[model samples]
Target chain A: MPHVQNGWYLAAWSDEVGRTLTQRWIAGNPVCFYRLGDGTPIALEDRCPHRKFPLSLGRLDGDVLECNYHGYRFDGTGTCVGVAEQQDKPRAATRRFRLLERDGIIWIWPGDPDRADESQLPDTSWLASPNWTHVKGVLPLKARHLLLVENLLDLSHETFLHPSTIGNAAVAATPIEVTTSGPRVFFQRRMVGVQAPPFYEKSMGLTGLVDRWQDGEFHPPGVFLLNIRLAATGTEEPEGFHMKVLYGMTPSTENECLDFYALARDYAIDDAELTTFQHEQQLSVMGEDVDALEVQELMYATERRRTVESSIRSDLAALRGRRVLQKMLAAEAAEESGGAVPATR
Target chain B: MAPAARTAGDSGQRIGSPGADEEITVDVVRRRSVADDVLELTLVRPTADPLPQWTPGAHVDVLLPTGIVRQYSLCGDPGETGSWRIGVLREPAGRGGSAWLHDHAVEGTELVLRGPRNNFPLVDAERYVFVAGGVGITPVLPMVHAAERAGRPWVLWYGGRRRSSMAFLEELGGYGDRVRPRPEDESGQLDLATVLAEQEPGTLYYCCGPSGLIDAMRSRCQGMPSGSLRVERFSAVPQPAVEEPDGGIEVVCRRSGLTVAVPPGTSILDAVRQAGVDVLSSCTEGICGTCETTVLDGVPEHRDSLLTEDEQEAGDTMMICVSRALGDRLVLDL
Candidate 1:
């Protein structure tokens, strides 16, 4: 199935793109990202539309790109504005994807331009909020974006996959409950009087068997958020630290993804040591994930037989998320083929 | 950003239920009365093929053809992949799962099962002390073999009502003094005081049996080092009622014209049942979603693991077995 074109997918971190032209792949389509002199992020199809020369290989002047092959200049909208050898710049434009830069991330919509809705953007205000201390990073994921989505949605695997970092017996041992609304899927695991993992024990100062909560939500096409709580077991009041973790799976191809992750905390807002510790530790953890997922991607591509995999309780959210995206793709296909009439045979 | 965080808007809610691993149909290759009133069945893959690998403390969820599901600990050798063995004690007063198995299970019987899930895994330790009571020996049997194979210094304290009624005595005889068989008729209650004295640095204690034995071990574990003891209950121990900090709440059973007060130190399930409401409940500790009740109004301060955060936040349905109302009042669909 093709990528969910109408949906907003994260393109690049705001600070990652500046005046320099950078070519990035999205849903198997290469797109160039750069900022105009006004510091506004722009996303345009990398091809020149004429000779299919990658525009990203060209030079940038103020607010426009000059193709390297023929020195053809195009505006931020991928509209060809000037040509060095030809008169009357052909009224041709490479595809321009809509871009939205909000909360330190640039999001792009590659579908029908008129249908882009800003309200549908995920709420990531916490990333820029002063009340939360955060660490963010990205990985060139070598697996289907859905696999990463499934990885985040199925927290049960954490106990096994991330044993040294976040995984612990309690994570997989505790069961999860799934609930969904519309195209969104959510699953929560609450541990009442359970032993805290080492990460929680160190970061949140949660020791012994503590009351904990982990809730995950998946927004169709590629957004995942986890809300975590660690509190003293049987505490009369909600007394503990809270952490908000986010994962963005932007599909670059069927076997490749751009994984964006950010972890924000309500406590230790000014603890630089903790920030550095978490940043380094999270990188190590994600490195392990990428290693496992890359192998999986290889298996997913070359496997010949129909595998006998089964879904259990913890897979409810992952399964539901896949179904929701499937529905979106089905609707798009039906609409695209709606007007075609066939001749009588 | 959410308008009251309602989960039922435009999106239908599906209550999550406990699901098992992929089902595997196996044949009951052999059956025998391991002990008085104790039935032992050996299961193998239908084609007499090797089964999935399992560890010491793993148990299989037997989904009987009658639609009833029961769990039995694997008692056979974990090294043997071609078959698995389980022991079931026939309880006359208990549910009919054991009775059905006792009568219907035979050499040719086919049973569908899920998992060999290990909740009571044997964590690596310098030394091990295994305490088993009667049928609980089923789980401990493999553990004994594992501890021996690992060359870990270990001892097994096996207890039952009578020597004749206890299973695995003949097999355990191979262990010599490593296995201590304490029949109640022969040794009066197994001396827990003597066992407690066996505690030492780097010693890990594992126990499984009736609530009495487990509770006793739990009480004595306080004197031992923290995390040194691990025990698996046959079923979820009844969770004691504790008042939410928000205090007691009034629940209106929408189907029935009755309002029940769930007070501090009282569970909503117990309170409703006490109020003459007959509700079906199983695994009352909240893992099973059998006691899920629809919430027509008011918020539920969810304490159960069966409902997702969105479901709890939606204030739609709740597993009343452990969850309570968040506010002072709740309207339930009964």
Candidate 2:
């Protein structure tokens, strides 16, 4: 499937972009990201307008970026400000994207600049806020972005995929509520008066039945915010433990994606040992996903036409999410083609 | 300006209403291109009844044919109950909301509009200074008229990319010297420093615009009288980073009759969730104002962007998504 082109995607972490040029593919578009002298980030088409040279191979001179091939200097706005040994500055300038930094992440809009509203940026404050100590890492997956999105939206896979860490029978046993709003879909599942899973016992020290809740919100393209909560069973108390997991999946190519993961917690503020434990545990769990997804991608490629798929009740949220993405993609196509919008049922 | 009252429910529904799920549809009676890339839409109720009364800064959510809901200010006079008018700027790079409105929202088209909720209500003041940038002049248009009708001294500093791109120019022509229309093509950027230099004691400063313009006005009005500046933000304010606490704290769930030790590097939210208790939360960041939990007997370290300084000082609730307990143990209502 073709990736959505006209939305904000996580380009890189703030630390990843600096004076040195860095190149990454966003939704199959080659782009280069760099920061100016004052640390304002900029994203431009990786290919230079002149000879289609990758700008990432160029050198930075203050706010001006000089293409290594021809020494063509471009300003922060992607306007070609200088040319090598040329008396007149040419009107040739690379396409510049809207770049925004929020919560320690740099986001780039790959589509229309007129529609690049900063407010449309996904909220990832929990990962960047100081009150929550989080473990952050990037996982380059061989699977498509939509597959990763489906995996994230369907928490039922945890029982089988992450049996040692965040999995339990209750996840499959509990009923899920699938609801949608605009381009976002939400999956909420609550397992009331259920036995505390081993992960909860080891991490939270819960011994008896507990009320566990898992809520995941899916944003178009590929972004998910998961809110997990646990409390003693039969308790009306509002005081409960909670954690937020943020997933930012950026499609680097048709078959590859960069998954930015952040697991933030409200309980433990600054314990290095806990961070290490959680980080190690997550790495092991995510390693399983990475392994499984790679094989799935291979199978998808091999049996491109022979494969058949089926959906269960648990896949409702993922299915809704897919439909929302399809509609958005269709709308974008219609707008580009100047055709009538697709009819709604 | 008072914070826009945010109704939290699923989008495309009347958030606070009970059993009233149907949308209010209105007929687009007239559509005119007021300026380049700007459109003025006049809407009236499908019935003979008058539209809901709205304050000067009120805005209605217009549901477009493209399945996107956009908020547009009520620029028409409040006294005119027969119809409502809104100005929309066609943002070429936007998410298709404005473009759909500019292209498809024409005469005889029916649109669903929700709420004339005023987050930017005009306050009582002896004098006022209004500053607007580009398409942000919509909300201020009605306020200027209200100021004129009340016989209050007021001045408007409106600006856009050029003369052609600025809307409602003919409407402001009646105000003469009181309205300063600064088109960037003819004049440079608005001299905010010069306009705000003279601080009138009772003058309430109202501004609505892009972040750059708002930030300029904020810095310029720093030394002026406190509470004199009011702004309507089209985007969220950047949150300040909080320092992580050093050690784990014990949380006492009063009703659950349980005490959970939140190990270091974990949040109270994570601990509670791990314990199997679900809290209503959305943007797990402090920004969305979701996951706000009441603190029954302990001081909460507030890190959310939704609360004001005074609310933070009160220490009644904290956004669990990114906030933690201050002391070793916290007694919570949850």
Candidate 3:
């Protein structure tokens, strides 16, 4: 019925939250993110309890936030530390979310504090490793998080949606294998002895037929890891180009989501020009996805009722991923209802 | 040019009462003295609804309890939606508006406000130079936060009578050297000439202060570049007169289809309003750009301090309150 709360969502990039208080929305809740004197990042509800003024509008005295409105101050723990000319601070406090900084990203947990588990955080170690060159970008999408999740889980759209860069007719023409292990859904597609896409041609210097393999894994509530390898045809050499593209979709509202994407590569680690070129190419492809998803969202809004839709063989991975999310949501609802056995849709 | 007979019976609308709009009431939840005479008032909507969103450099027109309307910059962060903050400097020798706000406006008082209009908007630049004096620091406060958030280089030269007279000094201290607080007593007068020297190519200058500081910065920035300096003025500056036309000015209201002749000593706004054409106006002086009218076919003698020289030269729009027609017959969009 609503967004699954007991999960990690990307709050912002590591560099975005700094000395000054920054405000962002996660799961339709306003959040204020800032760092302490020792550079420890903190996430708290943006609204002040006294007059509902955003703590971000306030100034920071070390780690304490002073509300610019009436001078109400809050500590890093969201406790009311001081009030102007008043002693004995009231019990007024804002909600403090669990925040973790890892792998150049800040993760926030807006669910029950006791249920927050650090182990559940997505693995993004490649983005921080010096061995791999990475380029990251953030896009605010008008579509729902589920729509973006589906868009990333299915690779067939690449052939049509992204024709210039990563797209080719072979991606849609080739059959894909779908499998699931626990909460992870995997989609594997192989195109052998096919023309190299324009993106690989320019980036990898491939001018002839090549063997391309795409293996994507979806980890809910919204993380997609796509591993791609391209090598010369009829050769199993060790000099093939490999890339790891990671996507993290965090829902800002019911109908809005923030897409955080990082493209990492093991090859061409020293080429800054290649990194810039790949960054622009990735941004262009993502822009195309956003355009398509926004239009799909508009169609869904106009047609309130869902009609009978046809599903192809390539949609198996997306369907499986949706089912996993549904199970998670149902389990969360059941737990909240004191294990009384909630109805599953 | 032929002289047209002046048409009479055209009465202008009274000032302050523009039209009937929804009255949004906000309660003064908190008030505190931040400086010697400056007070910061935090106003919040009584209902649970979020207040109107505003950007940096926007100001709201507050209708004081004494029925006096005054515009104050929303100095609070634009990210805050629940409350709006305004800093007021108590003027002893001037209008009673600021005095009434200082003496009577207190916490828990409810005030009706009209707008959060932004006449001074911050544009994108590689670097920014902010010069504020006395109460003029209100609008520049939020802009500094914006520049910091954007990770752009900026320097604020804030001047007041004394360090104790400046509001938000404690808050500005967090920014460290980026904010230069110049108390007139300790730092002498602001050496705007030296500070503004060696200007960068894409550096934008924003100055809001007394007339002397504004004029000094204006002259210093004359040779820099066009549209490089943006200054907000509290009072209107005297505009040079255009060569007078041979006849009385004829203004044709395109929408209302009324032709009125405005003789010498009469403004085009008064002439148009006299013909039952209602045009919104605030601050009858050309300072407030409220009575700005679009020009269809006319060369306007621009007198308002709102538009830049290039904008006035384009002649697409003119402030009808003070500026008049340069030719005998002119057409107005009305």
Kindly give the number of clashing pairs for every candidate. Answer: 1, 40, 2
Report iRMS (Å) of candidate 2.
17.3
Give the per-residue lDDT digits (tens) of candidate 1, residues B91-150.
775456777889899899999877666656777899999998878888889989999999
Docking class of 1: incorrect
> Would you list the C-alpha lDDT of every candidate in the order shown?
0.77, 0.76, 0.78
DockQ each candidate and list the results.
0.01, 0.02, 0.00
lDDT string, candidate 3, A174-246, tens digits: 8887755445677899889999989999999998899999999887786788998998887685568889998
Candidate 3 off by > 4 Å: A339-345, B1-334
lDDT of 3 by residue, B223-289 (tens): 5555677765443211111124334788889999899898888888898888889998765666455
Q: Which ten residues in a row have the lowest lDDT in candidate 2 chain A?
A: A304-313
Worst 10 residues of 2 chain B by lDDT: B2-11
> What is candidate 1's lDDT per residue for A154-262, written digit by digit as tens?
8888788888878788888888878755466778999888877777777877767798889888877878889988888987545687889888789997789999889
Which candidate has the top score in lDDT?
3
Q: Which one wins by lDDT: 2 or 3?
A: 3
- C-alpha RMSD values across all candidates: 27.0, 20.3, 29.2
Residue pairs with backbone overlap in model 3: B10-B274, B11-B274
Candidate 1 vs candidate 2: which has greater DockQ? Answer: 2
Fraction of true contacts retained by every candidate, in order, equals 0.00, 0.00, 0.00
TM-score of each: 0.51, 0.52, 0.49
